[model samples]
Target: MAKLILDTFREGYGVDQIRKTMTVGELIGFLSDFDEDTPVYLGFDNRYTYGGITEGRFEMDYGEEDDE
Candidate 1:
């Protein structure tokens, strides 16, 4: 099983926004507030490995140490 974190955002006059830390099947259940066929944009912060696919998904680290 994978751990997932869901976050949502609504703009002034834009489509409903949803973000997740990792892809999960149950993630769709959280979108009940929105339309059933609404278009969604999914994104994540991860490293691209092999054939340009994201792997070892991890949050970006930024700081003096990261700048080195």
Candidate 2:
């Protein structure tokens, strides 16, 4: 297992971040809290972050990390 890093910035909500020592499986449940339109940035260990647009799925596991 590795650390789970999640960050987000969206329309209504301001910037948010979460750091936890968990695997991919644990991330799904936590992600359910956000709306489909919510955008998120995900990272594993010390790797580059991936950006994700939560637009349709009720829950998501991955997204491209757009830091620009």
Candidate 3:
């Protein structure tokens, strides 16, 4: 698996400052710099999980909140 790093958080990226969506073209542009053989994984709760893209079923999740 390819290791992806997000060092921007240390530069002051927060929930409110992060983008919530990306178009396919935008995604391609963002990933154009990376190697083609890299595996894609989704990050959540500081953990990375392999998205079922190859299985033809991709799931999108926004995570959960305490709502307290």
lDDT of 3 by residue, 1-68 (tens): 67654322222365455556578899889889889877665445455433323655756756567522
lDDT of 1 by residue, 1-68 (tens): 33233233333452223333434555556766566555443323432212222347545556465444
For all predicted structures, in order, the TM-scores are 0.23, 0.30, 0.46
Task: Give the winner by lDDT: 1 or 2.
Answer: 2
Q: What's model 2's lDDT at 39?
A: 52
The lDDT for every candidate, in the order shown, is 0.41, 0.51, 0.57
lDDT at position 56, candidate 2: 78
TM-score of 1: 0.23
Q: Sort by TM-score, best first.
A: 3, 2, 1
Candidate 2 has its poorest 10 consecutive residues by lDDT at 8-17
lDDT of 2 by residue, 28-56 (tens): 77777667556555654444546444557
Name the 10 consecutive residues with the lowest summed lDDT in model 1.
44-53
In candidate 1, which residue pairs clash? none
Q: What's the CA RMSD of model 2 in angstroms?
A: 14.7
**Which has the higher lDDT value, candidate number 1 or candidate number 3?**
3
- Which stretches in model 1 have alpha-carbon errors above 4 Å? 1-26, 44-68
